[model samples]
Target: MFISFEGIDGSGKSTQARMLADALREAGHDVVLTREPGGSPGAEEIRRLVLEGDPDRWSAETEILLFTAARRDHLERVIEPALASGKVVICDRFADSTRMYQGLSRGDLRAVVDQLHSLMIKREPDLTILIDIDPATGLSRAKGRQGTEERFEDFGLGLQEKMRAGFLALSKEFAPRFRVIDGARDPQRVAQDVLETVQAELPG
Candidate 1:
């Protein structure tokens, strides 16, 4: 199975992704926990370029290219091999992030983003768990982890609000493969809910 966990910065999707991978492993399943923008070595180099620079270092179009390049490398090098080995791939973020970040909510290039995705990478996760949370709360949590990859969080609360709405809309648009989970609760509670939801879908 291939799963992707997505949400705004500090929504605890990363934590849940890790927890889910660990849980699956404990159940004797072969699992590979990975993340977008840097899942493979080549993608990691690209990740540094897009994530570490100044906020205005790249134009909307340029940023989309960088993200797509990184994603393609990740899928080809890391994700495909693990999935071929029958390992459950749990990724912290995936293409939906590019669709949200570069596709109008954060940037102004929705059409270009869609075109690039279709022309290059056109795959979706089997299941996507969106850890939904309020923008203010998520921003506060993100503030505590500011570092080199702070560009997205630096987008401010207003943009985050818009991104939240965009993600919610995406969940509806991709309802067959999307699972929206409340992320405002405690981490353990959120993890429990995430595990249960994912478990129900797993083949026993």
Candidate 2:
């Protein structure tokens, strides 16, 4: 199973992704936990360029292409091999993130989506879990965490709101493959929701 978790910063996707992988392992399944833009070494370097660099350095189109490049590396090096081994691959984020962050915020949805589709014909996740949260609250949570702000994380609330809306719109368009979870809830509750969703989606 290939599952990707999506959400704004501070939405606890990383935490829950780990938790889900642990649970799956306990259930006797082989699992690989990873994150986008930085799963493999080359991709990690690309991640720093894309996320930590000056926001003004890259145009929206450039940002989208860079992300897709990182994803291509990640898929070739990590995601595909693990899936071929019959392991569950739980990724922190995937193509949906680019659609939300660049497409919605930058006002070039079709171009970004088309480019991504061209690069990654097998890019779609089997199950996508979008953790929904208010941008203000989510930002506050992010502030409490220990890390320098990435370019995308530094985007304003308006952009994050638009990104959230974009995720919702995509979820509506792909109901069978998307699961939108409430991130405002307690972590355990949110994890439970994700667990249920994954259980329903994964084959026996």
TM-score, cand. 1 vs. native: 0.96
**In terms of TM-score, how similar is model 2 to the real structure?**
0.94
Q: 83-155, model 2: which lDDT tens digit per residue?
A: 9999999999998888777777877675656667675745689999989999888877886775754676677
User: Candidate 2: lDDT of 16?
Assistant: 90
Off by over 4 Å in 2: none
Clashes of 1: 0
Q: For model 1, which pairs clash?
A: none
What's the true lDDT of residue 135 in model 1?
Answer: 91
lDDT of each: 0.89, 0.84
Supply every candidate's count of residue pairs whose N, Cα or C atoms clash at under 3 angstroms: 0, 0
Error of 2 at 4 (Å): 0.5
How many clashes show up in model 2?
0
Among these predictions, the greatest TM-score belongs to 1
